[model samples]
Target: MLAKARQSLRAACDQLNIHPDVYEELKWPRETLAATLLIRMDDGSRRAFKAWRCRYNDRRGPTKGGIRFHPNVSLDEIETLAFWMTFKCAVANLPFGGGKGGVCVNTKELSQTELERLSRAYIEAFAPFVGPDRDILAPDMYTNGIVIAWMADEYSSITGQASPSALTGKPLAFGGTVGRVDATARGGYHALRHLEKSLEIDPDNSKVAIQGFGNVGYHCAKLLHADGYTIVGISDSSGGIYDEKGFDPLAVMQHKHETGSVQGAKGHGKTRNITNAELLELDCDVLVPAALERQITLENCDRIKARVILELANGPVAPTADRKLTEEGHIIIPDILANSGGVTVSHLEWVQNRSGYYWDASEVADHLKKTMERETQAIWALHNEMSLSMREAAYIHGLRRIAESVEARGTQAYFDGA
Candidate 1:
């Protein structure tokens, strides 16, 4: 994953004719920390789990990313995620670099007490490296606001300091931004809104399909549906349900909440159960892969027929598929830009924590809309002016900022002096 991420960045740099030396400093992470987390099991036995934190860069600002608790977590994956976070933050114009941390454990198997202990232990182990001005951790896969709150509390108690800014995505009572929960989806909506004029598709007339039913996917479906888009299909990990005429996203969400899946929800349109692969190929105006990385690969790029492919999931469209889709004239909204709302809101949360001021939901939403629109226009303008792919244009736009910062700081002089 790290190799692929570096390849994508390098490809973009090459298209821009960026000097290889400029990229030499950007290719590898500044630091990668691995630790063993010792937690007492519910059965009174202790187990050690491997955990990792990767700080990709700090040229722009403090590192910002999430801590994911999953069985498949590894140092390489965390580093790749941190690298993506750097670009994502840069694309969003946030004052943050990239960092990510994760523990290789399935939280579902642990009891509530055990989960808390594990969360604290993970923070305790990494406390020396993370802080408000260092690396700030948020919530990611299998981790939520509760986990973030726990981690933040642990950090504060351990350090005996008031450091709410050390983490984002905590519960609102603990300083989380009001719009953080749906920030990722909301950001995607803003990107799609900005692209509507270029795509020449009316929201009311467009049929939308989302290939994941998690927080990001469901919230995206809701926001788009409220905006008058016809949600034609929705899916989860198990499978997806499709309706040709369009489905009520709110109803589907309620059903999914009750039934734990959207597979068997009764609807007016054709209720056919389809695999995620089949759902991706459905004839829709916009297809959103909000699930996981590599969902859209070279093998399945030919099957996609959507006019606009909005990636709400991180790395949902693989590099190989990205090339194919670009060749096929698909307006692929890259994840760095499409799914940056969460981090944008995280910035808001951090600001609020630092300033002791908070905004209402409408205020937050309006602020988010303006930021997303401005950034989208910037990226779109760059793409048109340079005749480059959106992904390449975004990378060029973001990398230039980071590269300029690195140069302005005389970073190379320090090494030369050494």
Candidate 2:
């Protein structure tokens, strides 16, 4: 993942003809901290979980990113994610750098008490390294609003102050942004809506297949399905359900919630269960790979039949496959631009937390929609202006922002006076 990240950065820098120093500056992380947290289990045993946090860059502002709790968490993955977040925030024109954190543990394997203890323990270990003005953490992957509340409470207790700005994705009762829960999917909805005409999408006839029925995936699918698109296929970690006549995303979500997976979502229609890989290869108008990274690589790139790819998952399309898909005229709304609604609202939550003021859900949704639409249009315009791939265009746009910031602060070469 880190290698692919560097490759994209290199391409963007080369395309922009940026200063060598700028590329050199971005080649490494600003800071990386790793630690092990030991907590006693209900079985009267102690288990140690490895955790990591990486600040990719702070040229723009304080770092902001998500803290995921997945079994595959690692320092390299966190660093790559942080680097992507830096670009993601810049692409959305947010005042934040990139930071990410994670602990290598499966949340499903833990009881409620065990999970709470682990989440708080993670905050305790990294409390000294994170803050609103330094690095703010949000939910990602297996992490959610409840988990974020725990972390925020831990940070507050540790500092002896109520600082909800130090964390995001909190429950609404604990100072979270009003519209943050569905921000990611809502943003993608606006982006795709902004591109529907250009992408030649027929809302009445468009067949959508979403891989991953998690938070981001479910919300995105739900929104798109409500917007008249045919949600023909959808999946979770276990598997997926597909129907030629299209399935209601909400019903599928309800089934998943009740049955622990979306594998057997019946009563609405006759749907066949499919694997994640099969879902990826399913012929559809728009394919949303919102599950994990490197999902649409070269091996499966040739099998993709979607006219458009909206990456609700970070780094879902490998760099090589991205080139191929673009060459084949498949419009890909990159993750930096597609899934940035979460961080954009995270910034808003930080602002509200700092001001000790809150806005209604409608206000948050309006702001998010405006930002996502504007940024999506901007990327489309850049794509046409430069005759570049969407991913390349996004990278160049963000790289320019970072390059300008880096030069402005480091050399003061472009400024007239100090």
Candidate 3:
């Protein structure tokens, strides 16, 4: 995954005439730590889970990223995510380098007590390596606010002091900032709305199909639906539902809550159960892939009909398929820029933790709106100026910032007095 992701960096560097030393430094992670977490199960059995943490780079500031709990977690996946986070923070112009952590375990199988124990055990193993000034952790994948609270409490216990700054995404009573729950989706929404005129999209006539009904996906659907767009299709991990006449986001969500799937949700027209693959190919103006990586690949890129794709999930489109889609004139708002709101607000949470002051939801929303617009406009302008894909433009924008930081530390040319 990391190897494939590097193609974008190389292209950006080549376009910018960047120094070789910058590419050399960015190609490898600065440090990665691995450990096994042993937890006693509820039924009097003990299990061991493999885990890893990687700080890809820290030239900008302390490393920042999330810890995910999934059965497929591996060293390669963790480091690749950290690599993307490094670029993501740079693109948002946040003072953070990329870091990510995860444990190889199915969170669904664990009871609440067992989950808490595992969360704390993760901190116990990595406490010495993490700090507010070193690597700050947040929630990701199967990890949520309660899990983060447990980790923060463990960190405080280990350090013999209140250390809320060591983690973000905590519960409200602790250190979490307001407006964080929907930040990721909100960021993408702001970007898409900002470009509506340029993209020739009218919410009144546009249709949207979304894959993945998780936190980010549902919020994206709700915000867009409220703004007058027609939601024609929606799906979760299990299956999908589609109707040409559109569906109400709230109603679908309520159905999901009651049934644990979107299969029977009602739409204005004939609602029918479809596979996740079918949802991606539905006729719609906008398609949001808010699911895992590589959902759109070589085999299915030709079948996609959406003129615009808002990537709320990280690396949702594969590199090869991305090239094909771009070549075919599909406008893709890349993940580094589109899905960056979570980390942008995570940075806000870090600031509040240090200052001991929190902003209201309105204030946080305003800040997020401005930041997303500024960055999105900049990348769009770059894309037009260079006749490049949005993904390329975004990478170049971020690479410029990272290259500046790398060069500031004195490259070989400076030593040779070139």
Candidate 4:
């Protein structure tokens, strides 16, 4: 995945005839660390889990990204995510680079005590390389506030200082921001609002279908639905539900909360049960792939009919599908920009934590809206000025920022000399 991602990014730069040195610098991560986390289970059994942290670059500032825990976690995957984070932070104009960590373990298989021990062990192994000024970690797939709080506490205890800024996405009681829970979706909402104007999308007449009913997808559906966009379909890991007259977002959320899926939600329009793949190809004005990566590929790209594709999930569209979709006139809001809200709000949380001050939910929302709108406008302007695809424009915009930083810091010499 990391190799593929690097090739895709370099291909974009090559198409623009960017400097070879710049492309070379962007092809590899600045640092990659792999560690084995040893923990003793409650049953008196000892186990070791493979974990990795990849800091793609810090040309902008400190590295920042999420730490995920799952059975499929691998160094290549973490490197790919970290590479995306570097560009995502750049697109959002955050003073940070990209870094990501993950452990290959299913938390569900561990007892509560074992989980805590594993979290602390993972932190202990990576402590020397992570800090508020080095690499800041946040929650990612299969990792949440509880795990973040544990890691933060362990780090603080080991270092003998209360460094809340060392981590974001913590519990509110532990210096987390009030609006952090829904920041990703809310940030995407702001981007979508700007998208509506830039793309000339009619909100009232637009139909949206979201895949994945997790934190980002659920909130995106609610916000867009409240803003008068018709939410025609929604899905989870199981299946999808669709309605032509538009299903109620709130009702679907409530039903999902109760019944664990959107399949049985009460709706009047033409209803049908569909798979996630079918949901992606549905005839909707907007399609938001909020699940995992690689959902849209050449095999399925031809079936996508949406006018706009909002990638709420990381790498939801494969590189091959990117060109196909663009050729078909589908304006894809790339993941880096579309899903940057989480980190944007995480930055806000770090600010509040360091200053010992906090903002109301409305204030946070306002800041998020302004930042997202500004970034989206800049990207769109570049796209129009250069007559570039949105993806290319986004890459150029972000890569230029990072390249400028590299040049200013004289790090370009590293690539030039190499």
lDDT value for candidate 1? 0.89
Off by over 4 Å in 1: 411-418
Kindly report which residue stretches of model 4 are placed more than 4 angstroms away from their true locations once superposed: 15-19, 411-418
TM-scores for all predictions: 0.96, 0.97, 0.99, 0.94
Clashes of each: 0, 0, 0, 0
lDDT of 3 by residue, 173-228 (tens): 98899999999999999999999999999999999999999889999999999999
Q: Model 3 segments beyond 4 Å from truth?
A: none
Model 4's alpha-carbon lDDT is 0.89
Ranking by lDDT: 3, 2, 1, 4
Candidate 1 residues 40-81, lDDT tens each? 898989999999998999988999999999898878889999
Evaluation by lDDT, superior candidate among 1 and 2:
2
Following a full C-alpha superposition, what root-mean-square deviation does model 4 have from the true structure?
2.4
Whole-model lDDT values for every prediction: 0.89, 0.90, 0.95, 0.89
Tell me which residue pairs clash in candidate 1. Answer: none
Candidate 3 backbone clash number? 0
Task: For model 2, give the 10-residue run with minimal summed lDDT.
Answer: 409-418
